[model samples]
Target: MNIVLTVLEVTAPVFLLAAVGFIWVKMGFEYRVQFVTRLAMTLSVPCLIFVSLMQTDIAPQALTALSLASIAAYVLVTVLCFVLVLLAKLDRRTYLAPLIMGNTGNLGLPLALFAFGDVGLGYAVVVFAVMAIYSFTFGVWMVSGGGSVIKVVKEPMVGATVLGAIFLWQGWETPRFLTNTLDLIGQIAIPIMLITLGVAVARLHPGRLGRAVWLSVIKAGICAAAAWGVGIWFELDQIALAVLVLQVSTPVAVTSYLLAEKYGADADAVAGLVVISTLLSIITIPVLLIFLM
Candidate 1:
């Protein structure tokens, strides 16, 4: 009973903030999604990642273990999803990327912080970084048939991740004032991301929702199972294991839809995956938290 309350306590704010965005959009408010997304990705999210990694108390060794575990888990998910897409006779360009990439940033980060505190956020950052890079490069390539390594290199988040990892390894810290400023900026990332998620979903026009529903179910299962198996094999500690599973099992990201729209690969279908997967996460996330907790 207490666990149920705890799970709800952790998740309510996330969905509620998202609901705020949804309602705002429904009420016809001015919410500039492109500007908001750019701000979060280019500035706030990188700060969050760097600060979290810099201030984390988790051992460097444990973080490295989790990083490798994350890469392995994603690899497994990709293979499984590829097979699923092929067998289902779905358009690879439209379905595969959404199946592989999850909303680790908006939903997963907040859930980790609420569920397991600072340590969990730190661990979640590592997984998010891995997924972000992979999504930027390989995931993009899958959809567009051509990904630029230079584009990946230019991403602010990737730069932040590399710098943060270096700092963590070297046990370095910035000046206190700078740290506080970055922390303040980083604080906005969670709420901004959550609200932005709602806005994006509200604004999207999804198609093939029936197909998306079943695919979302399959994605959640595959991601959670893959992460769980890899986490155990890698002997990640309790928090690390939980965070990995949660991050990897998050709903399909809105970015996947954006990428599809940009690259002209069934944007409506990808949007369906994003919306349905996100809605499905409301139930799936709490259930996983209950088990993980």
Candidate 2:
């Protein structure tokens, strides 16, 4: 009973903020998604990652282990999702990326902070960075039928991750004033992301919801199972392991739908995935937190 309350306490704000965005959009408010997304991803999120990594007390070795573990977990998820997509006879271009990637940035980060505190956020950022790079490069290519490594290199988050890792490695800190400024900017990231998620969902027109439902269930199972197995194999500690599983198993990201729309690969189908998987996470996330906690 205590655990249930704790889980709800942690999750309620995250989902509620998203709901606020949803309601706002439905009510016909002006919410600029492109601006907000760019601000969060390019500026706020990178600041959050940099500050968290710089401030984390997790041992350097542990951070390294978590990074490797995250890479392994994603690789495993890719393989499993690929096989599942093939078996289900889903269009590889549309279905494959959504199945493999997740809403790690928006949902996973905040959940980690609330569930496991600062240490979990530190670990969560690593997984987010890995996923960002992978998604920008290979995942984009998969959807558009072409990808560029240079695009990955130019991403702000990538630079932030690399810089953060270096700072962590060297046990370095910026000036206190500068650090505080970055922290302040970083603070808005979670709420912005959550609200943005709600807005996107509110705006999306889902297609093939029946298929989306079943596939979402399958995605939850396979993602959790694969991430768990990989975490155990890598021998990550409790927080790292749990963070990896939660991040990997998050709902299909809205970005996947946008990509499909841009690349001409069944946008409505991807929207179905985004909506259904996110709805499914409302239940699945709390269940996982109960266990993780």
Clashing pairs in 2: none
The digit string of per-residue lDDT tens for model 1 on 1-293 reads 99999999999999999999999999999999989999999999999999999999999999999999999999999999999999999999999999999999988999999999999999999999999989988999999998788988999988998998899999999999999999999999999999999999999999999999999999999999999999999999999999999999999999999999999999999999999999999999999999999
Off by over 4 Å in 1: none
Deviation of model 1 at 270, angstroms: 1.0
Best by lDDT: 1
Candidate lDDT values, in order? 0.95, 0.95
- Candidate 2 TM-score, C-alpha based: 0.99
| CA error at residue 175 for candidate 2, angstroms | 0.4
> How do all models score by TM-score?
0.99, 0.99
